[model samples]
Target: MAKDFSDGIKLSQPRPYLTRMMLFLALVGFLLLILAPRIMDAFLANPGLNGLIVGTLFIGMLYAFRQVLQLGPEVKWVNAFRRADPGLALPPAPQLLAPMATMLGNRKGRMTLSAGSMRAMLDSIGSRLDEQREISRYMIGLLIFLGLLGTFWGLLITVSSVGDTLQSLNVEATDSASVFTSLREGLQAPLRGMGTAFSSSLFGLTGSLILGFLDLQAGQAQNRFYNELEEWLSTVTNVIDVPATAGENTTPEQASLLALAGQIAALTEQLHAEQRLVRELAENQAAIRPALEELAGSLKKRGS
Candidate 1:
């Protein structure tokens, strides 16, 4: 796979799995989360904690978007295959597709397509896809955990402060001015605690919702890509077996010939499936030539 840099941005197919509506809503929500805290200072008493959660959410979103872009090449590869473009160049190979490309390329055009091999290939692709998406799942869980932590921490501080204020109460003091002042000062701690509690929960829950939705979108994109790849493979793959003529009656001398016949039959089926597949056979000619030469030598020895 080749990387393209027409501009500063790398060119890739299936750009940004997120839709325009999703992007707009997420941007608006983020802006509100950032700005609302400053405007409603009373509600968001602990700006520092809120800021940390917001920053973490931003990092998670960015990471998800990056993964979305990385998945582009796999989608593109499936599209190219479906279009029957043997000459089409690929973009930078994605993790899910890298092993597949390596397998095909290593075959030197003499590719094998057995049911077991196909299952293994699909399993490898699925594993890579799971690994790629695992981070988003962790990020969602982290956001929720942060929210709960903030909520409980704030409540504990509030409860402790209220208890201390009750213990320090000078209710029997004669000075009314001193009493009022002490009461007002005592209330401040609880108010601050309330602010911390509400603000953290707001940001944490909001961030979790936003990221969860985005994760769903990314998962859908991945599933679509996987489906397309499966479809493409189904169309191109051909499995041939030794014919009845080469059954129990076939002599040992004919074994090599039967193998050659089976290979040709498979290739013929491949050509029927996609005209462009024939062009690809040219690259495999050298790879297959040695096998053919060996078979021919065996035939001559038997005849002699």
Candidate 2:
């Protein structure tokens, strides 16, 4: 189970800069949204077309910003997971590969390549697995937030516009043109507000649903990879415990007990040789599983 979890973690790691860039864009989008109303009021004096454009931009930016924020945390989580597994080794850049090959070839090139490839594979897998969880969670939360924000903004506009229309109607017989103008303005607010609310919510919900499905797929992949890793690791560990043959005269029971004892002894020696490797692996697995489970739960809840 531990090995399986580790493999899942490996496969989930975030992309090099994709996550970061998304996060940055999201943040900028959010900031623009925060100042959207003021900016619209000041720069866009034309309330009809300009107001619609500003509202659209604001809602779009808010949706995008929320998504980015969610992604940032996910990337951080993946990076942390990668750091926990000491056994995993990230691959060197292509430029470094040539020098590494030259140096390794001087001694045991094949052995070096084998070890390096194994390590690199583990690292890459772990990183990607970690990232998958992060992206999944971000998308879910982002969609929900975007939907709520749009709804709230829409309501505000609707209420405000309705109040203005009522107030204008209550006024003494004023200029017919001015009264009609006020009524039109009031009507426009609710109409525009409704459009923003429904459209943004629809987009946000759709995005969330799509991403949620992808997250599930990623989780399944992670689980499969983890199972394979566990099987391989178990085989390797067991190989280290293979016992030497005893004399033919030895009883089957005696041979079995001896083998068991030998295996135990080998495990102890292996643990000692690797210093804290066993303990670290155990600790890393412990830390990762709970977090992964938590993330899975969170994703499920969000999807629901």
Candidate 3:
């Protein structure tokens, strides 16, 4: 559904990914509420590492939500500007599209925005979005790293504990009862270490999963907004006929071929002109050579 602004503008019914993102977050919250006790115990097992992972995941979610939120307003703003009457004023555009607004505002009279100009605007907007998503991606990687770090730490502790337990085992006891008690007591250290490893892995993997889904939603919203802006720009984009400017329809290879063809045609024309000049020079020399021979014979007769 399109949102209606106070200025009487309606959206073009974009992807609605922002609403979907909110619903996804809501579902996540509900699941966490139900699993709160289990989650608490897992975190308590490896509080130092698990606590840090949760904190990182929370920050990632915050950044992802902000990305979606920022995109929503910008999408609305672009739609409003696109649909408004050309003679009237539009509501203020979002910061993402401020450069475009400035370009249009600074125009003298009868502004003609070229396709290249629109593309430059989209590039600026896309670069900013890429920067925003980079933070979320980094957080996801960090969560996995923390998980693996905890796993190795736990394994190290488990290995050393097992070795120590085996060394202290007094198998010299003559009675089975004393040997069994020593073995049981020795196993507790390794079991606690194993618990730390499993708990950290579970929490870290779960947190990353949640953050990944949120980032997916944010990416979709940004893509939709970008496409919407592109469509809107096309409406105002003018196709200029410039010999120096390459057309979008032509690839670089095609342009190079065209240049080569032109050069070949010019060379062919020059060669034809040179051939015509050479033919004229030969005809003139043949005609003058006969006249000179006749004059030389007449001079020989007069001298004799």
Give Cα-based local distance difference scores for all models: 0.71, 0.53, 0.78
Question: Clashing residue pairs in candidate 3, if any?
Answer: none
Best by lDDT: 3
- Answer with 2 or 3, whichever has the higher lDDT: 3
TM-score of each: 0.66, 0.38, 0.73
Q: Write the per-residue lDDT of candidate 3 for residues 55-85, one digit (tens) a residue.
A: 9888888888788777666766666665555
Order of all candidates by TM-score, from best down to worst? 3, 1, 2
- Candidate 2 per-residue lDDT, tens place, 130-162, comes to 664775576577666766677678778878878
> Which of 1 and 3 is the better model by lDDT?
3
* lDDT (Cα, tens digit) per residue for candidate 1, span 76-162: 664453343343455645566777776554332323455556677788998887887899899999888888888887898899889
| Model 3: CA > 4 A from native | 1-15, 83-93, 107-111, 244-304
lDDT of 1: 0.71
Worst 10 residues of 3 by lDDT: 1-10
Ranking by lDDT: 3, 1, 2
Candidate 1 C-alpha error for residue 279, in Å:
79
Residue 243's lDDT in candidate 1: 60
